[model samples]
Target: MRINVNQTQCGFVMKNGCYEKMIFAGTYHYPACMGYKVIIEEMRGRVGFKEVPLKVLKEDAAFMSRVTMVEVPEGQLGILYINHAASAVVTDREAAYWNVWEPCELRFIDMREPVMDRNVEKNLLRLIAQQYYKKIEILPGEMGLLYQDNILTDELGPGTYYYWLYARDVLCRIVDLKMKELEISGQEILTADRVGIRLNLTATYRIADPKRLVETIKGVENQLYTRIQLIVREYVGRYRLDEILEQKEAISGFLAQRMREEQEQYCVEVQTIGIKDIILPGEIRDIMNTVLIAEKRAQANVITRREEVASTRSLLNTAKLMDENKTLYKLKELECLERICTQVGNISVAGSGTLIQQLRELMGT
Candidate 1:
């Protein structure tokens, strides 16, 4: 007997009750007079019960030139192929060939486990993503919120996530988890002493709970900013101008304490709060400068007057001592005469006979 198969077909032959191994397309001649059993199976990409071909094919078997083929791309789930003859699942960029003898069904599933949005997978069988893939992009030191149908579901941190698109009707909200600053500048407030002052404040904060952030709090940044501003006003409003200027550190501490108490409610934590500046009114500043200068000048004048009085009192005591003691009076007179003699460059008496006696007489007079 002889059998022929085309290149498009694979054949299995059973001879003498011993089933032969799987064979490919070709022609084979076997000895006659021996019992010959033949089974021809078609490789169709389908899953079902397939009937076996019993008739022994000589040269009359149909030849197929092309076969059905299915391919699965990388990063994709198993590809399911089924028909009336066979069923299979292929994984990881696999290529499969099936006979065209029957109808074949082919399907590719994503291994990412996201099937809620078919549109997302439709555009990307490999690396390319579709537009329907709602993106939750959180930069480093950032937090993200995932919501499905208006309900908060998951909190994400610092990475690109397909969860927003993988699930159906999901929405994403991103919050800055890094430290951020808020400023309140040129705020005109009235102190307890009825002084009008301009207060400038700065605050730094970061998000703590991303999941409860959107659900429990609204406008977290703005809310925190307003809280700081209000706290500043309250603290500064209670103190006088002098206290506010001198006790800026205390005011900052007060604000921080308030934020600490209320931070958890807003899902944010305050790193620091400070008074950038405490600006007085133009007239108040000029008055303060003038008063400071006048007070300092008064203190200097008092010191000068005290020193002069001390010197004059000391001179009076020395004069009293000289008057009471004759010896001291004589010595002081002699000292004055010595100072006078040194002032004159030359002292030449015309009558050189008794210069010392004449000088003594003049001194006595």
Candidate 2:
């Protein structure tokens, strides 16, 4: 029988299904009486010496020199590097690769400990199967709570973390520690005056005690929202619509103080409470506009009447002064004549009577 192998492949010759020699690219002829056969395999990737055991192949210096052997014992992991770049994660007990194909190196990671080695490149974990390991990343302004098998294991700060998944069921809960806004949008409630008003409430808060918040509070946001709603209702129910509108700042202050008092219970710090908007019903708004217009008109009328009364008093005083002083009266007549002259284009002061009599006629005209 004549067998051929390509340059990128190698062949194994078996004599009567017994031990055989590894052959490279070439042609060879053997007698059929010898029961010779060849098995060809591509040697560009991982080496697969299926026809012969590794112990037997290791004895062949040529075969051993052409390949690299990676032994990954139990409770250990192997990271295979091809040409100085991470290529694959090896979890099996042993693996072999062709050294002639590419430069290969193996790095062993001890799995006896669940925590990943700090020296190991975290990016290399991408090559690992998700079922074999767990990864957690807590960002800035966030905290991570690590749990194993439904039990609290550790509280983790903001950073990347890894664990062996086979040891336990890993779970991480991230809680944001930054300031957050809780907006209760458009809550309709009745005031003491039985006036229905919609209020948009906003509260700024932050997680003060993350551990307590995680252990004690199931739903912190929902509970805090309910508390704020009740507080608003309680305070608003005691005030009339006019009072609420007038004392908006005072109401906000009271609510903030009340929330602060209960901060420990919710494991949150209440920063500020604000009445974002006080929306009145359409009918009430219209009625308020009407009242505002009427009030403004009344005030304007009062101001007008006050100015009129002042003018009349001043006129009476001026009349009394003019009656007592003839000169003052004459001066007043001249002032009136000057005003009348400004209005007329020409004044015909007929050589008639005195100038005062002429001015008096002009004033009458």
> Where does candidate 1 clash, by residue pair?
43-99, 46-82, 46-83, 46-86, 47-82, 47-83, 77-111
Candidate 1 — which residues are off by over 4 angstroms? 1-112, 115-127, 132-137, 148-153, 159-171, 306-365
Alpha-carbon TM-score of each model against the true structure: 0.54, 0.83
Give the per-residue lDDT of model 2 (tens digit) for 244-319. Answer: 9999999999999999998999999999999999999999999999999999999999999999999999999999
- Candidate number of the best lDDT: 2
What is each predicted model's overall lDDT from 0 to 1?
0.68, 0.87
**Weakest ten-residue segment in model 2 by summed lDDT:** 356-365
TM-score, prediction 2: 0.83
Candidate 2 residue runs with Cα over 4 Å from true position: 6-9, 15-19, 30-36, 42-44, 49-65, 83-85, 100-103, 348-365
Highest TM-score against the true fold, candidate? 2
Q: What is the C-alpha local distance difference test score of candidate 1?
A: 0.68
